[model samples]
Target: MSSRFLILFCGALVAFGISGCGAPHSPMTLALVTQPTRKNSLVKATSAKVSAAHQRIVRVEEVPNRVVTQSGLSVPRGFGVQLLAENLFVPRRMTFAPGATASQYDVFLSESKADRVSVLRVRKGRVVSKATFTREVSQPYGLAFWNNWLYVGNTDSVVRFPYRRGTVKAAGGAQRIAGLTKGGYNQHWTRNLLFDRSGKKLFVTVGSSCNSCEESSPQRAAISEMNPDGSARRVFASGFRNPVGLAWQPNTNNLWTVVNERDKLGDNVPPDYLTVVRQGAFYGWPYAYTDIERRIHADPNFGARRPDKVSETRVATVPVQAHSAALGVAFYPVQGGNFPKDYWGNAFLSFHGSWNRSEKTGYKVVRVHFQNGQPTRITDFVQGFLRRGRSWGRPVDVQIAPDGSMLFSDDSGGKIWRVFYIGK
Candidate 1:
């Protein structure tokens, strides 16, 4: 055959092989037979890209001359602390809504005492406008946004309202989605809410009714989960005296929280902790406490009702200082912003500040270092919320801004403080 004809014949054979049109015995058929292997490898490569897209790699940068708040506090040398907004009515938890630009985001603050969700228009790291987003929220503590709906955790129930991007007010009235164990004068009343990455499951943390007592309600002292519309409510985990802060670790997708252990156990008996919360796992509240070594320490309240030794309880991942009242937990973004390179994958915790201990502890934010999705060390990131044997600000919740600044709410001082690294 002529050279041109041979070239066309070879091209036809290659196309037939790719399309699986060649005979089984033909040499060109081998390429078709192996196509599935190559296709599967391509699928795996695509999956790896998807996973990497979800994984964040945070690198530190620098910005200067932001509004510096006069709050007496100390952050790292290369960082600056400023009050983003002040005079918030007992703000507890914060959530952000989509904005027009990268620098413009609407921050929704749950005013626990004001019975409303307040909206703050943040433009380039400054509060431009503030207004009441919604009212009559019934002691809203936790705020989360999903699927154009804003979920608010009230003292007695979980409610949701319709929301739109860049809109200041909720579109409609609040709808009760789930009922929580509430009534009477309870010691721990705050119900913090968090949604899974898929937004399929909603997790709510209910504190114990009393200190170290057998809770009459099963949901008390436990983390509960349910559908987005409040169906199939079940206890995810139990035995925590007060699991206040809830966060999901990046990359691992593991649910982690910080718990406030029973008080009056002496100054340093049972330290507060940050731990990976497993499904249906108990952490030993009225019966016992899992120490740093994963050893079970029986609670004095249970006496013989609690065996001195028990199994099946998971220990804390990292034990914090006693009576620190660790209340809010937020993981640093995988794509680090202005913070240090070492801060990537670390968890920032807000210790609301202890009131029961002889000496004050935890009036600050702490950085829990993580290696391969597991905590390795805990370090103080923000301090000086307490000064001169008195505290003027008590941080209640923490959040990471879209621009990569660390923002925390201080209810005691009615202020929200932003901490960002000022690159050297």
Candidate 2:
């Protein structure tokens, strides 16, 4: 089973489980204010009325799974540990390198399982080369490129390695960055890493250890910043259940993030949000949530009495939809006079599909329309991740390649997809 078939088949299985529930949406015409119907559907990609503002929407033209491989650089020895491609793209398992200690990270290792973090060289919408770069760590996630180096975050720590751009192969093994607090369940253990535009500082996010419990200190479920070479570490902000994605605004260079809110609030009480992160701000997690005014509403679960030991930060800026599980954010810098000047400043984010919801949400990439440092609206850019009432792909992260094309990662399909705009 190739990656494509696996995605399609799993999508079909999910659809079969919920086919009799709803109807898809139809095409639309622009108006003064376009309102999207609150309903789930199984519609074709081109027919969806989701708008992209001035820019045209580019859908996925091709998605091939398990096509990525390793650098042929002789991974640690293991017998009967063949790289089975079909088992590679499943959603539940954590893919890791051969001979890697399972205890090092939370990877999917069974009689049938494959590794994550495969590499590929793509040009003109086709994969020219491929490799699977596995490391001796637990659940290698969150990849970022800065100054010819590739930084990846594992369950416990962040790893860095020298990378030659466009060469789809690892330059060498990884070096560890010190100072990260671990001890969380497997799901909340994901550590997302980001770099500032000037490369002066590195930002890392660690999710809350429990669903809605008071943390030991301020660092848990908060964003932290440090010097580029891993010095002068300090908590940037707190009160996020899971801040998975971080990006710098292209025009202002201000930091922003997409947070995954806590679950079990009657399925729709609190909404997941995207917000601008300030250096000393807090957005109220575990003790408060977003309200109509976007301020922190006192928590029905835990009252706001613990402000001394745990901070009760105010809730400010927030994005659309709750529990959307918005993960990866990528800013598209205007390149060589191709895109409009306004586009140079905007950002693109992938909501990697939602789980534990009454009705499924996210499963697509959205554009954050901003002006003077605030969002005007959140518009849909890519749809069809949730197909035929099921998710064919759950986008995890987005990155801008050296060539200016957008690279989107789907951990659900175990594949990385590329999208570029062409004049119609």
Candidate 3:
């Protein structure tokens, strides 16, 4: 650890009134501390006096008599997993066809490799039909439906096609809504589209161009907000390395995102996290990151450039396994859905797995439980992607079906899996 990081860690121990402020401790030592939600938690990513010590992962039940379980994969007790669709070419985010009810719905997904939108007709947990909704486009990654328009967020632009619930493919060309900065450091290339709760504005997440460097443009490393028709574009927040999944907390209306943090920090330096993405918040990309002790530390490499920026960097809320590559997030709706009542208002994340660790971690989905509009615990919902230290699939994003089941995409294996409750 750098001297500055150590000093910041020690200072937190003293500030929190914990005993043994001077004694040596394992870097991974964990102690739970209360994190009170702010009065207006939705307005900003509130600072946690302390951050990640250890992630709270509960018991993960192994399901029975399932194909995925053959490879040692598992889901929670009373829940069962079934294959929804197969043979997709690198599917990413998903959206249910509008005007559908119950388990009878068509899901639209983006095939990044195919560069087209495909719609799958699902009936009672199985995909009965698949067809190309639109084929002519760039690297399409995000899909959304609003006001009879199927909005597509390609790698380089936002476009829309005339869409109807039962129509598998559109009739004409797309209308370009917005053009985006094409590539970045790792060539992030994936552009995610999200509509705010009010349904009047749209938010687009654009990642920084490099691993950890000063960005050359404002649009890089920031989330852009604009009118739904692609007008009035402006930076909503900056300093995000790669914020992938965006969702809204129901009770508090707080915007949440799962960020894929920088790599090469050795095994577990700063854990990847899900936090409220407040407007104008600087999330310490090249300058700092909140550590296990809940204190934000300046990056030893770049903190010297802007000491003031490092000091004011907003603290992260819920911290997960470092390098877990948290990508897509979706919270169960509080009003309606097929999930059990206990699951309502909880958020689910797709951990796309990790490559920078000695022993690999995070190759499944997790349930992030919330209390008083704040995340409190994380528990595995699905697993076994990494068996014997080798992975077969990488979960990219998660979504809740209108009928109450959960759907997630695995790009590596080109498959979609659905989980549902089988018992009380």
Positional deviation of residue 2's Cα in model 3 after best superposition, in angstroms: 28
Model 3 accuracy (lDDT, Cα): 0.76
Cα lDDT tens digits, model 2, 1-424, are: 2211101122322322313112222111111111111112111122212223311111221222112214111111220111212323432212222222212211222111242555543443355444655544456656666777766776677777776644545688877875566767437866777778778888889899988888896778999888766778889988888888788776675788888877765444466777778777667677666532233345555644553222335443543455677777767774442334555656777887667776677787776655655554455555556755688777677655444445566667655554544332
Q: Which ten residues in a row have the lowest lDDT in candidate 2?
A: 29-38
Q: Give the TM-score of candidate 3.
A: 0.85
lDDT of model number 1: 0.73
**Predictions: Cα RMSD each:** 17.9, 14.4, 6.9
TM-score of each: 0.81, 0.69, 0.85
Top-scoring candidate (TM-score): 3
Task: Arrange candidates by lDDT, descending.
Answer: 3, 1, 2
Best by lDDT: 3
- CA lDDT, every model vs. true structure: 0.73, 0.55, 0.76
How many residue pairs clash per model? 7, 12, 6
Off by over 4 Å in 3: 1-72
Per-residue CA lDDT of model 3 for 313-355, tens digit only, reads 7777666777888899999988777777878899999999887
Error of 1 at 286 (Å): 0.9
